[model samples]
Structure formats: structure tokens, C-alpha cells
Target: MLTFEEKLTIIESFPELTRNDISLGRVNFHFEESVKDKKVVVYRLHPNGNGFVYAGEIENSDYVTDSKGMVNIRDFTEKELRDVIQQSIASLSESETVTETWINNEGQTLKLIETSGVWNIYAGDDLDATHATYHAAADYLYQEGFRLL
Candidate 1:
């Protein structure tokens, strides 16, 4: 396992990591506290590479993609990746909650209902309107630190 210091060093040196914005040439890391204090980190590599986010514990391995894309991490080691994931989880566990709203494109009212593992969308009089509404809702949830499965 990579130590915290080692992880910090790798993160600082890695040209792929971006702490400021989520765009090409940047990686956005977020930690979620809801899932047993789980940490989530997302990497948005340059357009040429696959964009993905690695998340989970340092002792055990777990990862998920931010989007469907590929990336080359030749400069980093497995331990470094582990450290980054660990640090990200720690950081997100202490963050504040951010709320956002989702609007229907057709002026149809939409509602967010908490389901067991996912958030459900309910549209008023228009199931088709759910497409845009859910898209906005997913975006809002992602911005607020929720991951889609």
C-alpha cells in the first residue's frame, strides 16, 4: 500500500490529476459519506484517453468509470492508485451537502423519490417527459455526490 505522503506526491506529479475543474486534461475527485464513509474519485482524462473514476478502499480494490473511455497511467503504480482512492474517500467523507433542482423540458412537474438503491423519477401526466427530467436529475445527483449504477 502507498502511504499518504506517497499518494500526495503521485497526485501532485501526475499530469492527469486535476483538482480544479472537470474537463479534458482534468480529473475531479469526490468522496461520498453515505456508503459506509466510502470515497469516490473520478478522473476525466484528455479526450484521447478513456475517462474513468476509481473508487473504494485502499486495503481492498474497487473502481468505476466516470464515463466510457480509456486512459494511460504509465507514470503511476498500483500502490499510488490505491493511495489516491483512499485519500479521495477520506476527503469526501468530510464534505458538505450540495442540493440542486431538476426541471422538465416540457414544463411537466417532476419529483425525486428516494428508492432503495436509486432515486426514482415521477412525472406528472407525461411519462415521456421523464427522459429530460431524469437526465437533469441524474446530473443534479452527480453534482451533489451521488453515483449512478
Candidate 2:
């Protein structure tokens, strides 16, 4: 089992994470640049060497999560710790970095952009509409008798 200090050292290795101590000697790591709902990844470590990591949207596999869907990091190695932390941070970061422009069949120009997971459609010269997802934004224009060019 990894000691508490060993776990702390491994967690501090990630530069993107900022450590904040909570009540009961527990610590929380917050990814400031994250624009998603899970910017904070939960890490609970106990003196008994029992610990857990929750990186949002857990997968099912050996040592992945309990029936409650929490990752047991009690016996996790340095590699295991690093991998989970990296994934946790990435899962909350913005998924898009560029804007794309397309034209409709009627020759109307449409600019598609995503900001903090909100998709926007700019038709012609101004921001025309907003949608929750990129696909939804595209679908809205399609329903307006717009066809991809």
C-alpha cells in the first residue's frame, strides 16, 4: 500500500492541478482552466491507505470503480495514479479549439463555433442562434431548410 506522503507527491506532480486542503486533512484538486461541470476531481485518502479517485464519467473494469462507481486507489501504482489524474483533468476541459464555417445549399454562410460547450451558429453576418451541442446547432439550421454545401 502506498503511504500518504507518496500519494501526495504523485498528485503534486501534475502542473495543471492546484491543491486545496479541506476539512479532516483531506485535499481537493481543482483544474482552473476547465469549463465543464466537473472541474474538480474528488480525491479522498485515509490514514489506513484506503483512497479513491473520481474523474467523472467512470468506466467499468477491474480496479476501475466499485459498484458505486468510485475508483479505488488503495493499491494504485505511480503510473495508475498519474493516468487517472490526467484523465480526470482532460474529461472536464473544453473539447473544441477551432471554429468551422460551412455554407448552406441556398448559399447562406454559417459559422459554427463552440464556447464552454455551448455551440453557436452565425448566419450571414451575426450570431444567429445558440444550442447545447454542436450537432443540435447543425440540426436547427437543417430544420430551417438549410442543406450543407
lDDT of 1 by residue, 1-149 (tens): 33334544555553333454555555454433334443335555333433344533322233332343222332446554544443344333433222233454444344454322223443331111112354666776555444532
What are the TM-scores, per candidate, against the unseen true structure?
0.23, 0.54
Where in model 2 is the C-alpha error above 4 Å? 58-63, 66-69, 96-149
Q: Candidate 1 regions off by >4 Å?
A: 1-24, 32-34, 54-119, 122-149
Inter-residue clash pairs, candidate 2: none
CA lDDT of 53 in candidate 1? Answer: 41
Per-residue accuracy of model 2 over 55-117 as CA lDDT, tens digit each: 445322244566544587888887677667655654566664437766766677787767555
Q: How far is candidate 1 from the true structure (C-alpha RMSD, Å)?
A: 14.3
Show the lowest summed lDDT stretch of 10 residues, model 2.
Answer: 55-64
Clashes of 2: 0
For model 2 the local lDDT of residue 141 reads: 74
- Cα RMSD of all models vs. native, in order, equals 14.3, 12.7
